[model samples]
Target: MERGTRTPGAFAGALILALLLGGLFPALLASGAGGTPAALAVCVLVLVGARLGWLIGIGERRLMEFSFWTFTYVFLGLAALVQFQTATFSTSTPWFDTAYNDDAMWAVLIGSSAAMLGIRLAARGPTADAPARTPLVDERRIHHLAALGLLLNLYYLIRVGPGTVLLTREELWAAQVARWPGNGLTAFVVAVFTLPLLVVFIGLLGVNRQRTDRGEPPRYALLAVVGCVLLFSVNPISSPRYYSGTVILSMAAALGAYATPWRVRASASAFLAGLTLLFPLADAFRRQGGVETRFAPLQALTSGDFDAVIQISNSVDIIARNGIEWGWQLLGVPLFWVPRDRWSEKPAATGSYIAEQMGYPFTNISSPLIAEFLINGGWPLLIVGMFGFGWWVRRRDDRMVQIGLLGGKPSGMDWILPFYLIILLRGSLLSAALQFSVLWAASWFIRGRRSAGSEGAAVPGRTGAHGGSILTHQTSG
Candidate 1:
C-alpha cells in the first residue's frame, strides 16, 4: 500500500473505535472494583488507542518514523497499561497519590496525539532540496574506529571490574549502589560508546549486504557477526532491559529500513511476540536469586508493572504537588558539561528529582519526554514541544532521504542518527542532549573524507525528476 493513503475519515473512525475499545474493555472488566483501576485503565487505553490511531492514520512509509512512533507511543502505552493494572491490582499504598481523574488522563493523551498529528501534517509535501552529498568514510577507517571503540569499551569494562557484571542479583544491586562513577555515569558512558560502535557495525553490515547483493564475496561477514556478539556480550548486565533492548531494537530498525513493508510488519509481529515471551526470562537475568515468582512472568510483561512506568507516574505526582518548572529543568542539558562538584547550582536531572521526591533510593529511572514536557510548562509546552520534535524528526529523515541515505539500501551513514533518534524519542531532554552531543562529536570525527574522484562519480547517476537520484542507489539493499 502507498504511504499516507488512508483517508482522514477512516483514520477518525479507527481512532474513535480504538479509544472506545481501549477505555471500555478495561472499564467493563474492572466495573466491580474500585474507581482507580477504571481510571488507570482509561489512561492506558487512551494513550495506546491514540498511538494505534496515529499508526493507522499515517501508515508506515519511513522506517525511522515508524520506529519512533512505535517506541514512543505504542510500546510506552503497553507499559503504561501494565503499570496501571499492576499498581491497582497489587497494592493499596498508592504509588501516585495525586487525583486520578479521566480528565487529566484524556488531556495528556489528546494533547500528545494532536502534537503528533500536527507535526505529521506539517511535514507532508514534496521532498525538499538537499545539500551536496559526501562520500562515506572508507571501510578501513570504519573498521579502525570500530576497533578503537571496542578497545575503549574493553578498558572500561576491566576498569569497572568484570565482577560487577558477573554478580548475582543481590550482589549486583549492592554493588550498583556502592559503585564508583555511579549508575548515571555508567549509563552515560555505555550509551556514548554504544552509538559509535553501532554506527560502524551497521555500516559494515550494509557494505557486506551490498557486496553480497552484487555477487561479491562477503568479506566483512565474519567481522559483522563477531562484532554483533561482542557488542551484545559487553552490555551492562545491571540494566539488562535498556542496555540490551536498545541494541536489539536498533538492529531491528536498521534491518527494517531496507525491508519490504510486508517483511517489516512480519518482523514487528515476531519481535512483539518474542519480547512478550522472553521478557520474564530477561528480567530473571538481572535479579539476585534469578527470577522471583512474586508475579507471573506474563503478568509482569502485560501489566506494565515495570519500573519505568512507576517512575513516570511518580514524576506526574511530583509535578502535581510542585508547580511546573517553566523550562528551568532544561538548563540541566547544557550545564551537564560541568561537574556537579564544580557547579553546585546545576539543576538536578528530572529523573533524579522525581526519584528524590518519591523517596526512592535508586534514581536511574526514566522520565520520558512526555513527563518532561508536562513538568516543564504543562499542556501548552508539551503540545508545542512535541510538535517541534515531530518537525525536527521529519526534517532529518527527509534530508537523509534526499541525500540517498534512506529508503533503498542500508548504508552505515543511514543507521547512526536513526538509532540515536530512537534513543532521543524515549529519553528526557538532559539524556537526549548528552547523547546527541556525543553522537555529533563522533560523527564529525568519523565523517567521510571527500576526494575529487569520488565526488564526481554521482554525475552520471543524477536525475532531474526529484532533484537527485530517484532510482535506488546501486549500493542500496
Candidate 2:
C-alpha cells in the first residue's frame, strides 16, 4: 500500500531472481572448455546478468514490474526467432526475403509483449487491486504537447520535402502498399517513419480525457505503432534502418499499460499488439514477388562501390551481421578468421572488426566491453572514457533525461515528430546522454544547496516525479 511497493506476480519474480544470482558460478565453471565453450559461457553470463538485474532490480526504478513485461518480451522474441526459423516457407522469394513472415514474427512479438505486459492486469483474479498513484495528464496538456509535436513533424517534412519523388510517386506507393517488400517502397517507409512522432503527439491528445470529452478524437495513437511496423516491413530504407518502430511501440505499450491498472492495460496491450501486427502479416501473404537483393551489399563491395559498400556495411552492422559476406576483404584479418567469405552475424561489430584487424580472430566477449576496448582506446581507456562521458552527461540537465525517457515533452505526442528530428540529426542524439547529464546536475545541484534549507531542496514538483511511483518507467529500449 505504501508508495512504490509491488505485489509479486506469478513465479517469474522468484525464478528470475534465482537464475540471475545462481547462473554465474556454473557459467564460469565451464569456461576454457573450447572455442564455442567461451561463447556459450558468455551467453550464460549475459542471460544470467539480465535475469539477475531483473531480480536485483537494476537500471530503472520499476524494474520488477517491468521485468514481467521483459520476460514476456523475451518470449515474443523467441516467437520471432521461431518465425525466422520457419522463414523457409518464404525463403525462395528473394534475399532471404521474408517480409511477410518477419511482419508476422514482429506482430507475434508485439502482440505477445503487449499481452504479457497486461498480465498483472489480467490476474486481478477476483477483485480489482486498488488503483496505484499513476500520473494523470490533463487533456489540455496532452493536446498542447501533441500539437507541438505535430507542428514540429510538419515543419521537418516541409524542410526536407518529399525525398526523391520518383521514390514515392502515388502509383508506386500504392503498389508498394499492396506488397511492402518492393523496392519502390523504400522512400515511403522512411517518410512514414517520420509520422510516429506526429502520431505520438496526436495519439497522446486522443488518449487524454480533455480531447475525448469534447468528442473522442479517433484513436490515432494506435496508428503510430502500425505505421512503424509497415515502414520496418519495407526492409530497404537506409535512414533509420532497422525499423525500430516496433521497439518504440513496445516501449509505449509498456508505459501505457503501466499508467493504468493491470487488467485494463493488459487488455489494451493485447488489442493494440494484435492491431499493430495485422498489416505486416497481411503484407507477407501478398508478397509473392519474393526477395532478390540479399546479396546487394556483396555485389557493391566486390564492384569496388565504396559508397554502396559503406552503406551496406553499416546496415549489416546494425543487424549485427559480422563481416561474413566480405570474405576475402577480411582475408588475413584476425577477427575475420572464419573464412574470407563467411559472414559473422552478431551485434557489436566494433569488437568483431577489431579482432580481425588486430589478428585476434573474432570471438565474442562479454557485453560491449570488447567494442569499448577496441574503440576510443582499448579496455583501460574504455573504462575511463565511458565513465567520464557518463559522468559528464549525468551532470548536465533534467531536460535531457526527460527527453530520453518520454521525449522532451512526450506526455501527449507521437514518435514521428521526434523520430524525424532524430533523422535530421543523423541519429547523433542520445537520450541516455541527456538522462546522465540531468541526473549528475541534479545530484550536484541538490548536494550544494542542501545546507541552504529550502533553497537547496528539490522544488517539490521535480524530485522523484518519475520515481516513488508504482506505475513509473524510467528506461525503455
Which portions of model 2 show Cα errors greater than 4 Å? 1-4, 8-12, 15-33, 36-40, 43-207, 210-241, 244-255, 260-373, 385-477
Q: Pairing residues by index, what is the TM-score of model 2?
A: 0.36
TM-score list, all predictions: 0.74, 0.36
Candidate 1 overall lDDT versus native: 0.54
Q: What is the overall TM-score of model 1 with all chains considered together?
A: 0.74
Clashing pairs in 1: 82-303, 82-304, 83-303, 83-304, 169-287, 169-288, 170-288, 203-412, 409-476, 409-477
lDDT of 1 by residue, 170-268 (tens): 454455445445656755765564566766666666556546656998675546654664555444455455445555555656655335434544554
Cα deviation at 464, candidate 2, in Å, is 13
Q: Candidate 2 on 141-229: residue-level lDDT in tens?
A: 44443454455445443443435222323433444345445432433333333433433433343354334545856465534643343
Q: After superposition, how far is residue 1 of candidate 2 from its true place, in Å?
A: 9.8
Query: How many backbone clashes does every candidate have?
Result: 10, 40
